[model samples]
Target: MAESLKDKVALVTGAASGIGLATARALIGAGARAVMADRDAAALERLAGELGDAAIPLVTDLLDPDSCAAMIPDALERAGRIDILHCNAGTYIGGDLTETDPAAIDRMLNLNVNAVMKNVHAVIPHMTGRGSGDIIVTCSVAGHFPVPWEPVYSGSKWAITCFVQTMRRQLNKKGIRVGQVSPGPVISALLADWPEENLRKAKESGSLIEPEEISDAILYMLTRPRNVTIRDMIVLPTNFDI
Candidate 1:
């Protein structure tokens, strides 16, 4: 760890688990003090304990605008300023578009897209005022290539991909860097504990990816020079053709 992020403050959503947790760890290891926000209160508390005092935990429901609003300010209060915002919270419900329940689609959209926008609304002003900051979004390879059985998830990821790219263009002049990291299939509690048959299918079909691999990619993006922003990253295991 070269301490590229020394003197910086980072806020990572979905910090209690998976990709978000990995990103938070990477940021903290690189010398940034991180504020972790998540809806899972119990898990968030446990993660906070393990991360020690440098990691601040905020229990926030991404669906709640007010919760999102409180995160950055609280982080600033504790760490002085926010230099990085990682919008990595998301959800998925697998189904063919025609067969998927509308309610499930809405939940997926709300968590995947709306939450990111809400955080951006709350945090970008501080970044703009300071004339610099970094935003890293967790999208998916499904955003680039569709997965038939997971139509809704694909749609949500595609939306994130588009949003991140637009944000990059919109904030470039302000020295605010926006980037996105897409992982093909990560073995996390979410995917690992998926219905047994689905897990078997994924294994048989060879679609598993490692969480640490994606974490490394995220670190690479964050460590790039101030003039550089990793517009998009797509990481997939060689086993899965997609």
Candidate 2:
């Protein structure tokens, strides 16, 4: 890392597992305190406890609009300040578009798209006020290319990719940096939503990347000089075709 983040406070959504969890660890490793937010209370508390004082467990359910809205203020109150906001929480729905239930699609969009926008919306004022902050979103390779199998999931990420870019351009003058880390199939709880065939094929073809890799990419983005913003980072497994 080119810069040390010793005094920074980072709020990571979906911090209980997967990329969110990994990013929290990476942030702490770089000397930043982590506000771990997730819906899984037990897992979240357990992980935060293991992370010691630097980790603050915040149980948040992005599914609820009220909770989503409160996340930024709550994190700021707890941490005193937020130097980084990792909007990494998301759900996945795979298979043919028709096979997906409308309710399921709604749930996925609520968490993956709506909650993200709400969180970013909530944090902008605080970050812009400070005249500095880093906002990193967990995007996906599917966002860049239309992956046929997970139409809903891909669509949500595509929305996020656009959101991240537009937000970056909008916030640049405010001295707040906004970017996203887009990864190909990562190994995490979110993978549970993948079709069995796709999951198996991913395993057999070594197409799945570990959460830590994405975290590393995120850390790299954050450590860059304030003047240099990595708008998007696309990480893929060595053998992954997509």
Candidate 3:
């Protein structure tokens, strides 16, 4: 069954590190080439090198309109075609809403929400023309329930959850599957904003999950039968509350 995915091309954003990196590796291990896109050119190049020819590096900042707009084309040029698009690049902003900077909110929203939508919109034509494709977004458990400490971040994910569902409805008829993998307190750079004490506590309590877990879920989503679609998969550690 896994061999059925051989030779497929998966374009993964934020592919330099964290969940994106894990997902890229998973795809490559499954015999698919990975188009790894990220702003961290050094990290991306290094990681791509580690993956050899199966990893195609596309260095572009998702926060930059021009760069983000050109990412799909650049990937197509480098990898030929994209059979899967994983919109997993994002930022996090936590704490009091009154204390959060307006500029920071815009940056987070632009990267977390707008960039995801643009990438999806830009790739629609290519997928439709092919009559088959898979799109998965990295949402959060906070998207399903309000997390007081991360109002802005939660709101961004909430927007994404709705977008993925609606997009799935429209894309399903076109032979394209749209879905989201919502994870809780993943061990990633996204937690850099968390208080050190809380982070330590979560780790001790086994509340944090590794990026590979999320990648595994995404791989399962991709390898499902053509008529099967795991629309919204919520993956979390056993100790995670949400």
Residue range with the least summed lDDT across 10 consecutive positions in model 1: 189-198
Q: Residue-wise lDDT of candidate 3 within 66-165, one digit each (tens)?
A: 9999999999998889999999999999888999999999999999999999999999999999999999999999899999988999999999999999
Candidate 2 lDDT tens digits, 20-52 = 999999899889999999999999878977999
Error of 2 at 142 (Å): 0.4
Query: What are the clash counts of all predictions, listed in order?
Result: 0, 0, 0
Query: 1 or 2, which is superior by TM-score?
Result: 2
Q: What TM-score do all the candidates reach, one by one?
A: 0.92, 0.98, 0.98
User: 96, model 1: CA deviation in Å?
Assistant: 1.8
lDDT (0 to 1) per candidate = 0.83, 0.92, 0.94
The best-first sequence of candidates by TM-score reads 2, 3, 1
Assess candidate 2 and give its lDDT. Answer: 0.92
How well does candidate 2 score on lDDT at residue 154? Answer: 97
